[model samples]
Target chain A: METLDGYLDMDLLRFTTAGSVDDGKSTLIGRLMFDTKTIFEDQLESIERTSRQRGDENVNLALLTDGLRSEREQGITIDVAYRYFATPKRKFIIADTPGHIQYTRNMVTGASTANLAIILVDARKGVIEQTCRHSFIASLLRIEHVVLCVNKMDLVDYAQERFEEIVAAFKAFATRLQIKEITFVPISALHGDNVVNRSANMPWYEGPSLLYHLENVYIGPDSNHVDARFPVQWVIRPHSREHHDYRGYAGRVHGGVFRAGDEVVVLPSGFTTRIRSVERFEGPVEEAFSPMSVVIRLEDDIDVSRGDMIAKPNNQPRVEQELDAMFCWFSPERPLEPGRKYLLRHTTRSVRALVREVRYKVDINTLHKEEGDVQLGLNDIGRIHVRTAEPLLYDSYRRNRLTGGFVLVDEGTNRTVGAGMIR
Target chain B: MTQSYQLSHLDQLESEGIFVLRETAAQFERPCILFSGGKDSIVVARLAQKAFWPARPPLTFLHVDTGHNFPETIEFRDRFLGDLGAQLQVALVQDSIDRGRVVEEKGPNASRNGLQTVTLLDALEEGRFDAAVGGARRDEEKARAKERFFSHRDEFGQWDPKNQRPELWNLFNGRKQTGEHFRVFPLSNWTEMDVWQYILREEIPIPALYFAHEREVIEREGVLLAVTEFLTLREEERTERRTVRFRTVGDATCTGAVESAASTLEAVIEEVASARQTERGGRADDRRSEAAMEDRKRQGYF
Candidate 1:
């Protein structure tokens, strides 16, 4: 039996994939899972049966990811589907999203929590308009790492010049975006070249395979640790007999390090106190950091409830009623217009907000701003000014994604209409 | 005072599960955790305990009993709930059958797994529960791969796979009409291997059916099924005593067992890690058709 130590110590990495209709995105994901031996024998049999029934010559690897019946029948992905696989080094979560123009909202949803993105570019077509649009979305969502997979290299005869030309063209266009790290790889996902193992076909290429890069990428510094931010989600006040007057603030630490005896301030109320203890289910800990859920007990009693934020007194978030942000409209039926009221939810707080003005709309394909189109329809990206009924504690989205992001809800239909990032 | 800031995969998954549980408590007026005495639900129940430590979770435990469950599972469920000091509401398939709410399938291959959906929906309506927290993981099946953490259901308790709301970041939209409810899955990101590893790490108690044991069984269509009164045997089918363990717990008629000697938690984890077949591969319900799970989920099956 294999030891459980390696499995227990493995970390996690979440990445998103983007490609056009014919870029073979599903095939790429399937290849990664298959070559790693993560695909079970039963699943392979099922896919093989389906492929034979569809009268395909070879086993269609894409059949593994197209889960929904509609997707299988129409040969298109309709929404986001999550897939999982693990190696000895790390566990991976793939947010496989559709690549159609109208499915921009789905891609945004997938990219919101991802640390990296894999954008597939067909070798025959080189970089096209769809490539630019996918890259822009990745930058807009603040994904730090990107792997540009030039797929179907077998079709291009594994030529070194063609791969270099595509890389150069993509690099020139990428200068406009704020992507911090970019790695270019040439692979043929259909024949399983350069996905999991070194390909003998492409002897000129000298780099780690796609899976190797994913397992070794430095995502430890991806989370913000300079500023402390915690949005209280619940108040745990057990009315049991053993302990009375036990009030603790329950939340997941958004950023920075929090320890016992540290001075902190509660937002909106402006009450300051010292942290008495930082406790998890096991016991009290010395310190807690980003993404760890724990209960914090303060030295003094104060009015802290749901939707309240706790942060260090020295480093506090911006408290303002009027704010500027970029909005991605999600509702297909309605367009965002000035002077309209909606419910804006930020952190844990929700309040009424009005759209004051539309500054400009971004043409994602060309990376150009159209100042004349003031209204944002479905899948349109634009900057707008919003005035809330209550002041919000936030930071610029470029600094902290957890504190600076929000969703707008339409009251009438009770549907999430838009997502915003603080500017 | 110096430590790596990064969390291990298990710790991250635990934190995410706890966060979702807390969100469920704060957002909905009334919620319940669907307990099946299976490893997945057992892990969920433990997370709920940690999520609201020093206090019993405000949510109740609801079990949709199919009357075809293994006796060991039902016994485990009762004892576990007694220890947790939480409330439990059992919706019985037998009661639904008595009321003619649902009809039982007849033949050599009859099972009440499909009948549990109607009883579950009826119980949710009667209890007026706004959220039903389930222990479903996306990696368990193909159709479940697209499920959201906060899955919305209409008033009729039907799921629309086509028109789902876009879930972004940690923000979940729980707003709904009066009669409509939601199916919240805290374990949507967990894989089968993760579930077993968590159970081993936390020392959570589960039904003995998960460990190797001797029981009367019959081999049908390459699946080792427990020989219970709920199952009707054919002329050629013969029962034999075998040492086996179950990978998943469900209706006795559908859940299958595998031959194994891993009787301890460590042994089970080792078995799961090295196992080549998917956990649900042994389930007979999923073998009905290519879209069996999707079709059942659309009609409000858990």
Candidate 2:
């Protein structure tokens, strides 16, 4: 997918940013876009005009990210805002999550698909509960790369000791969570230091700039490539003139790889088959790997449809009626009741699940497991057990995020009440 | 040659989009691609074709005709749909006005852009569609940037951005109440440059209007407006021939043309790569207010 003129196709890096309102999350993103010269003139003009109308001394860079009228009117970010920019080295997609107690669900949503998470720490305030909260969520979502941006360093006189103290505190909390790699950078987002370019004030800092690190970070190993999981989304049956009876199971390869003539077993049915072809829009490929959406044609008509999982025979997922998972309740009205029935949607499949038992809830601020509080309310993280009507095929959330994650929908209300990570 | 294990940016985007399209078909009972015959929607139509491949898209295309669209786009839409042998369901704004369901605004800047929501909602209700897939990218506007791949709408077809379902990973939550439907955007992550780059790489045919040519246009509110049949020139405005092309296609009165000499896909890509303003920056409809698009989307405008 390259042009004839030798246009280099850059690899994608999807990352999420989390910070409280006015913690410089939007400012950092705005600086990234601005320094990279990705901002179009018209957009800048509009933002400038709006800034002038608002009577700001300098053009507000935060206005670049607070896009919605309501958010701009209030001068704060409410929902998860997505921003895109590219350097010559790599392309980036930033899922900007708001840092509020009620916006925990949004943080989960934004970091769900991100390979990296940027947890912004204010140099003035140091490591607060919100910092620990963000880091815990990032690690919970399995984001391997965490960059602790100690922002507003100019206010602290660009102190290296201050940066190290916060870094040390973060590592101490991160020890309780599963975080693979952590990087520390001191940045003055408003003054443009150590974000895209090296800062003159912080002469002792030797690590790569934020942009440099983002562009060079190895994200290829971020996904789980050992397990082969293709949750069949749609069965492409194109009974046409040229290609009649084309039954291709269309899905994204969430894990591992699939090749032509590979042995695969369709889940729930327990029917084994060989792949006839791994076809993409370009043409038939020799093999297809994780995240590539392709139509897998089977050698036999084994009666597979949506909600079915196609996997390698050797490495199959656990299939059972009863399951245990760490669930994050997302609804404000109702608590996670043991007797409640929910539509447990996993990958492409959804089944009626009954809460069999209530587990202890988590006190995020203190990182303690509260035994008595079995009730899971809005933004509450707790372990729970459930038995679904139909068998669910899943892997551990620690092993794979795509196949292991699910959302619970209330049967009557149809609202997504909870997000679960299979245990 | 052995296949490389990595996918290009365009390939990744294509795959993600295809996955979204398939998910809609699998989850919802009835879904339609909201086609406006614009470049973005045309790419969406092509992606829909690729998603099913040997089969047709398996979904009807709901084109909410503003009755103020470019004739060229309509012609392109007919030809493209005809080639695919896909079903076309047109929801006309003229019908909405005739039935007194929506009133046409009066003024020199009066455009049916905002009124298209009524017709689109009526069409969705009439068709009993649970999903209306669109080509809106997050990079296009601020409000749309926060929109989910599976955006839930209330029974009145209103979008509550504050109360959206948390869309996690590729698993989209399409469950809704009896009358509520979802507006799905597969291209939420794609940028304008990515779209052009994809169009160039795939060599997909786009409308000639995307390329610059001599056109009768008038400058209004610091943006260029093409002289279409629906357009009424202001007393101070005068139409002139300029080498310009459209960054987007919508109601002829609202969508503006940009000054360029681009004529080919490669040329358009190059121009887009270096362009200063966003595709929607010149759009009069989006310029009505900072939250105009947000307000329209809340009311079910595509």
lDDT score at residue B171, model 2, on the 0-100 scale: 71
TM-score of each: 0.99, 0.97
Off by over 4 Å in 1: none
Instruction: Using DockQ, give the best candidate's number.
Output: 1
Clashes per candidate, residues 3 or more apart or on different chains: 0, 0
As a whole number from 0 to 100, the lDDT of residue B17 in candidate 2 is: 92
lDDT (Cα, 0-100) at A262 in candidate 1:
97
Which candidate number has the best TM-score?
1
Which segments of candidate 2 are over 4 A away from where they belong? A1-8, B1-4
* lDDT score for residue A13 of model 1: 98
lDDT for B143 in candidate 2 is 81
Tell me what fraction of the real C-alpha contacts between chains A and B each candidate also makes. 0.76, 0.78
Per-residue alpha-carbon lDDT of candidate 1 for residues B141-200, written as tens digits (9 for 90 to 100): 989999999999999999998546778888988889999999999999999989988887
Worst 10 residues of 1 chain A by lDDT: A1-10
Model 2 steric clash pairs: none
Q: Per-residue alpha-carbon lDDT of model 1 for A1-423, expressed as tens digits? A: 356877877899999998766899999999988877779989999999989999988898888898889778888888889999998899999999988778888888899999999999999999998889999999999999999999999999999999999999999999999999999999999998899987899999999889999999998655799899989999999999975888889999999989999999999889999999999889997898989999999999889999999999999999899999988999988899789999998887889999999999998899899896479999998999999999999999999988889999999888889899998
Q: Write the per-residue lDDT of candidate 2 for residues A1-423, one digit (tens) a residue.
A: 244334446678999999987788888998999999889887788879988999988878888988777777776777788899977677789999898878888898898889999999999899999998898889888999999999999999999999888889888888998988999999999989999889999999999899899999887655577899999988887677678877889999988889998999999899998999999777997777877888999999889988999999999999999899888889889788998888989988989999987778877767789886479888888899999999999999999998889889987777788888888
